[model samples]
Target: MQSTVNYLWHTDDLLGQGATASVYKARNKKSGELVAVKVFNTASYLRPREVQVREFEVLRKLNHQNIVKLFAVEETGGSRQKVLVMEYCSSGSLLSVLESPENAFGLPEEEFLVVLRCVAHVNALSGPKDSLPPKVSPRHEAVPGQRASSPLSAVAGMNHLRENGIVHRDIKPGNILRLLGEEGQSIYKLTDFGAARELDDDEKFVSVYGTEEYLHPDMYERAVLRKPQQKTFGVTVDLWSIGVTLYHAATGSLPFVPFGGPRRNKEMMYRITTEKPAGAIAGTQKEENGPLEWSYTLPVTCRLSLGLQSQLVPILANILEVEQAKCWGFDQFFAETSDILQRVIVHVFSLSQAVLHHVYIHAHNTIAIFLEAVYEQTRVAPQHQKFLFEGHFWVLEPNLSAQHIAHTTASSPLTLLSTASETPKGLAFKDPAQDIPKFFPKVDLQADYTTAKSVLGAGYQALWLARTLLAGQELMLRGLYWCVETFQATCRRTLEVTRMALLFLSSSLGTERFSSVAGMTEMQELKKVTELRSRLRALAEALSRCSHSITESQTSLSNLRSELLKNRDQVHADRSIQQIQYCLDKMNLIYKQFKKSRMRPGLGYNEEQIHKLDKVNFSRLAKRLLQLFQETCVQKYQTSLVTHGRWMREVHETRNHLRMVGCSVAAYNTEAQGAQESLSKILDQVSHQLLQDRTREAQVSPPLTAPYPSPALTDLVLQMQELCEEMKLLAFDLQDNNRVIEGLSRPPSAPDS
Candidate 1:
């Protein structure tokens, strides 16, 4: 790399090259810190010195983080080049970031707000007499009788060239550097003041300089009219450039193309003065069967919130206004945007936390209820003479009478006394006393419940910690949705056996042997079974109701989704039509303005005005102006029609995606309805079996020991258990579908202004 070696600093890398200078990454030999050194060719002598001195004055006085800091200047080498040592922005320029594919969405909205604040700060500092460098004269260094204005008044004043103070003649993305701060946040610094100059109070600034694409409309008028002496621009010209730069940074393209064909300059000037720049509307475009497009050549603002659009559009328009009086001052721009910036910052930071908290509470409660049901089923002892526990062979020792053994043996080869070894591999029953305790170890049922609850609570707390790092609200909500579904699935698996056990208990309660037992213990056990049966029936009924609601919601959401798509298409169509009408109206206004202000070279000019305007052709200029107006109107009208068609198609595709989501929801509802029906039937069958057993018990003699549940009851329990397991899985589906429908149905929150 070409290096610039000074007494205190030595360059190690060439950072960039420009027309007037080459920038290098240099290190201070004394401090060993990296810096940028701009080496300018000073062979032209006075011109380079003046520009360097003016820039040095500005940089030396600026203490703000948003403006580049100057270290020292040295005249070095045989060629008499001036080397400016400055702060090194390691991350390079904002322009580089904007052009990178990684930042296709443009800079974050927060960063744009930061840039606006920086601009406002710069304007504020420039207005104050004390803020200017001690040795440098202020542009409006008061004439003998002129009174000094307040700082606010001075900042807002743009009518008088001298009163408006420092205007950065060249403001563009490439001139803004992005420094990486200690916190890893980007710090933007405005640089390159080579084109800057002080203005006199006696006259307006007449210089036609700065980047052409960012040049003010008044500057264009002056240039095109070839009457620099007749009109001048003030600090509003800098505001105009600021608007162009902001637009380019946000959208990745210039509002006006300053360079093009042979007649590009004239065309650009005409458009700047009389037409709205492309990409000013913030939306994406689509064409039927064609590639997706943008209303503008480059559109970075697509999908941005409406509140941001509302603020940005007017601010940009006011800055780029043809009339300087209509242009916004820094104060006005700040007032218009500060509330919006604050709201956006808050919304961006708080949304994820809100969504996560909401999901956690619901998931935690559902899991708690599910675990309780599993604990209840496992803890209770079986009342039957023969029962299966954890797929193990078990016979109630006290209840296994000769009659129970005969009944069990008659129904299957396995008798009531069948050993665990006799059971099939997969069907071998686990000892409930041992195996069940392993899953819930505490001797006290309450203690086991408490322990499980604490662990679950801790897990949720850990989830909250992890959620702090998540970026977006929508992603967090989706993640929470999955978590809830997973928990529901686990609950369903655990509850499968519990539901069957409850059904068997209900069936046994109606038997003569159970009802005729001559003790309070039997009656209490019967009462407990009766209550459990009621609760199970109620639960099934509730699930059936939930399934019904889910089906209805899915249908409603499908309709709402279709309506939203239609409404969006209609809104886009209306906007396009309105824009076309606006263009035609503007064209007519331009025509009227042109007719009233058409130049009459001989009749209107005073001696000096005529002499200064000698080369101008007023008649030809009017004809060309009319031709340009016609062309601009035609272009805008055609673009609007294309944009309208694209929006309609885009909306159609969006609706199709929503339709697919609705179909998936409908499929889930179908499965959920089947599960709900199965559960209801299981409840009804148990109720009927209990009633039959009660009638039989009243007609027969009481048994000495509790009779074994009939083979029919065992079969019914097993079947109900299987159905409950299926219901558990179906419940998960129903829950997930419900959440999806809710998400689709919920209206979007309006962006805070």
Candidate 2:
């Protein structure tokens, strides 16, 4: 036996030492497994035998996922010392993690939540831990066996002790150890129950036992007396210590302190803690003469999101209150901490000017989103989105991970960098009243005879006024159509963001094997259920508003561009025979040039062809001059003044259309940002519910994949069908994002217009 012990463990491999025992790293010879062995000192052997027996009995009986396991016990030969074997936690104690420099302001939100969910709640839930699908994620191990006692403590820490009627006199950070799993997942376990004692009922007392800084005021006051004070400690002592330990974990400092430090002046620490103002939850007075400051708020620099802080502060307050009568009972603390564990977290994004948007995401989502948001709102590309975290522009190096950034990443707004700018030319409003004089040119009757003889003729004035005013109104109509299309586009994009989030959550429920743990289920029911319902109803309402946004444009520019072009054909040359002959000759010359250019580049238009083109140009001008001289060609027109009324009406109608379109676009961005927040929150809620539901359902259900599902459960088919529809929508959203990214260099080619 001595030879095996010598071979398995090295003499110098001491892990830690204390007054009662020294822990050493060792391995099992038979199993080839690593373990820790604690050998008692000579003096510990001389103590009362039941004290040692009670310690071992507690370790053996309290088996939980959150409690460390007991492997076996053996004695070393020659030394006559009793040796205890225990599970080895490769990761150090929780104190070591808190001492890290980055955590000087407390854990980042991501890390804090990990600790909150896994260690803080300490639930004795059913089913195995780390139940996520093997290929998709790493596994977390649960305790090897079940607890012999009832699982009464949902908020069990000391609740672990509370359930077993055991009170751990010391519940500080150093006593809480961490175990690293094979996959590198760490599980926190309540350890070192050397001062723990079992009670018969809820109301019980014992001699004061704990570290000074974390000890409750009642316990500390008695512990430090020169002549020991007569006072009894109960299960509630653990509650107070639990509060202090958690506060230290959260903000990297103790909540209550006095002159100098707790170690230097333990009496002062007791007075400050027990004699604070009625409602104060936390306090510290660093100097002997310094005034004490008290408040209910967590330090502002703590990485918890504002939304989460609102939930957690109340829980901390109830537990940490100096007034013992007001402190929350065990059941209340359990329920509240469990609430913190369930819900998916939310992060806030603040753009310049304190405009905030909520999203269900963390720091690891993507860097592209910030740049996208800037471009989408401002149409400003070539932008650099400098991220500010911890008061400096966050240089996102490879080492700076999403977890380090905390739970601040979320659904981000994005826009394409357009190489070509697009300004949708909507309706143009013009007053024909100002433009009418160009057609008539204000001139005295005698002056017009010398300098403006051509314009003075009534026929020319009537023809010009009708043609010019009609042309201007036709252009405005084209712009009005463009505005209608743009509004339709914005509406569709908003709907897609909302729909995709819901679909992804639904699809994930059907496809994945979710983690079955405490609090996983309730996070599924976020308060945003009403927000989701409101958003759906509002979508239908928006359709009508968008239609009204373009209402005036439709009536004002009712004519299509195709109709405007076709109307021009009948007006040219009025079907005269001479004009038809001239058009046919021009068409013949154009066709010859088209044939030459199509067959080869720069091969058309020889010197002979150029000479013919020059002759044609000279002949056309000469014919036009001859027309002015001939009296028979001169024609007369009247009522050119009557076109003024029609032109003025077109101008007024176009302006009204422009006003409505402007308002719709101006309001779109604010609406989109709000809708994004509500949808993101709703998606997170549904995802948690699905995970919890699946975990509980899987525990007793038949192999859902058995050759056939249970014949009595006919709804399985319906469930599968609903999930299939959700999966299809989720797939479409993913593919859409890919398509958008690929097309960002240029827009997709427009269909033939």
Candidate 3:
């Protein structure tokens, strides 16, 4: 027995006991590495060899960082009692961490995050590194066929085992070991394979095996195993066990109560089959062919806050998906876990900031209310001599509450800071009957309330207002965008009334309205009305302020779009030009060859040869010139229109602004209409004059019968030349029209200009 232990380990020590094995810690005799050895008890070894083989295969193939390692297996004396050697985890099980009183189970949040990240990484790398290599690596490999497709894979670590016909019938928190590495941090490892089994086993071993707290309802399914195996057990049963484990981690206790009966097995079976699972009892198993109530498992006592509870509740529900098909696969599990973790981080940060803001503001508002009450009750005070020079006589004496103002001999300024509403003792200052109403006007109160509601509803708008209040120009542009959107959403028209409202709101954020009681009430009513109407004039003013930037952004976007289109067109134009040039070059080359051929035939002096060469060369030159002229005209027109349109839009927007400021829309309209009429008149006159000139030329130019060409061909050539000249003239006229449009559309200048 000592030799057998030496063969497996260079060093060894007894650790503890399992249901069927005596566990030991050891260092590899060959490699000087740590491992665990399980010497199976005689009674369990007599049951089946297949159980041991299944456990061995499952552990060997699982090979995840989160899973405990099974190193080697051997038999002792006879094959009746076998021993399994696995990796030794120094940190021990989670149960030890939770149960030990020295460093209580209150794990640090950072520690929890580390565990989550480690589990996620392991799940992602679950499969073999590659298909070509049969040997598996200790490190996770994202090889094909090994990929887990869900975020829940971190919680449910079954893939290869299920595929190979093995099941970890018992999975629980105690079975999960925390291996300490490098620092004091604990790395989780799933251990204890004694109660696991294979699907193909024919032996008549009892199915009820896992710890009571972590067992699945399937135990009841197995109880009627003699009914000819009506249902086939699958991977989901293991997931149910994992769900129970997570519940224990979160609430620090079992979700269900233990059972009691005369016969332990019969009672356990009855409890599993009949009891309504705890409200928080979650796992990957769904009730099929049976009725079962689903809910959250209740805590034994009050534990965490609602927010913290909310953070973990959704995660529990996802792990406890009832339908097997809908259950999280490895890929989905990893993605979801990453997403939830990120959200949780953000929420925690935001909640902290919000709580701070709430506390500070609440204190400030309470103090302001208390001060106002004190000032109302006071008629005179020691500060009256100072008030004579300062001009405002309504200062609340230090430590003055309303109750004190009504009764005490003297008031304190601090009295105003309390939540009490009555006048404070001996509070003496400016009397309410003399001037309180005048200072705290009713209109101011109403305005304040309305402004608050509007600003609150318009979060983005409020942010813009805050930026302005802080005197930030860069943020103002962003604020303006929100303001404009808000105003547009609220108002029916963009006009002076809306612009003025925004202008005022931008400067003071409607704080003036709340300086008095009346204004506060009025403002509140106004806010509710405005919210219902979805209208606010300040938004328009905000938009107008941001107009320059908005216009610029729009112009930039348009220019970019235009430039892209222009580039595409230029490419097409270049291609066309190249094709035309190629054709022209080919024709020119052909013409030269034709001339050479013509010249070679007759000692270079024949009239027909000279005439043929001259005609072909002229035709080639004319085609090249015409193509160049047409392309030039197209490019010039396209370029001019794109450039002019930007200026035109700017002018048009300015004109609209002027119309809003009470300028006559008709005046602007008249100018545009006049420009259009003038352009049309000029085009008509040019057309008529061109026609007259053509007629005169037709009458006076000599009939084309020169250079020995036929009269008909000569006339046709002259007509074609005239057509080209007319088209060129039209291109120039179009340029003139573009300039006219630019002038007409430009915004009006200042009166001084």
Best by lDDT: 2
Model 2: per-residue Cα lDDT at residue 277: 68
Q: Which ten residues in a row have the lowest lDDT in candidate 2?
A: 134-143
RMSD of 1: 28.2
Q: Model 1 misses residue 379 by how many Å?
A: 53
Q: What TM-score, computed on C-alpha atoms, does each candidate reach?
A: 0.42, 0.46, 0.37
Model 3 error, position 277 (Å): 7.8
Q: Which candidate would rank higher by lDDT, 1 or 2? A: 2
| Candidate 2 structure lDDT | 0.48
Cα error, candidate 1, residue 194 (Å): 1.9
Model 1 weakest lDDT span, ten residues long: 355-364
Model 2 residue 700 lDDT?
Answer: 66
2 versus 3: better TM-score goes to: 2
Which lDDT value does model 3 have at 25? Answer: 70
Worst 10 residues of 3 by lDDT: 351-360
lDDT of 3 by residue, 1-753 (tens): 332543453224667776677787765666777777777777665666776566666666666677788777766544535667787888777666544321221233445444455444443223212213222222222324443334434434434443444555566767777877787767887677665655542223345666654554545445433333444444445555655555555544444433332134444343433454323442211233233334563342212323334444555554455444444443444444454343212111011001100000111122233333223323222232111001111233344322222211111111111111222121011111121011112223233233322222222222222222222211112222222232232122223332333343243223322123223233233334333112223333344544443344444435544543554454334443344344445444444443354434333347445545544454444344344434443333334334334433433343344334322222222332343233334334433444555456667774485434345434433543443343344334434433433333232221220
Pairs with steric clashes in candidate 1: 286-646, 391-428, 391-429, 392-429, 392-430, 510-693, 512-697
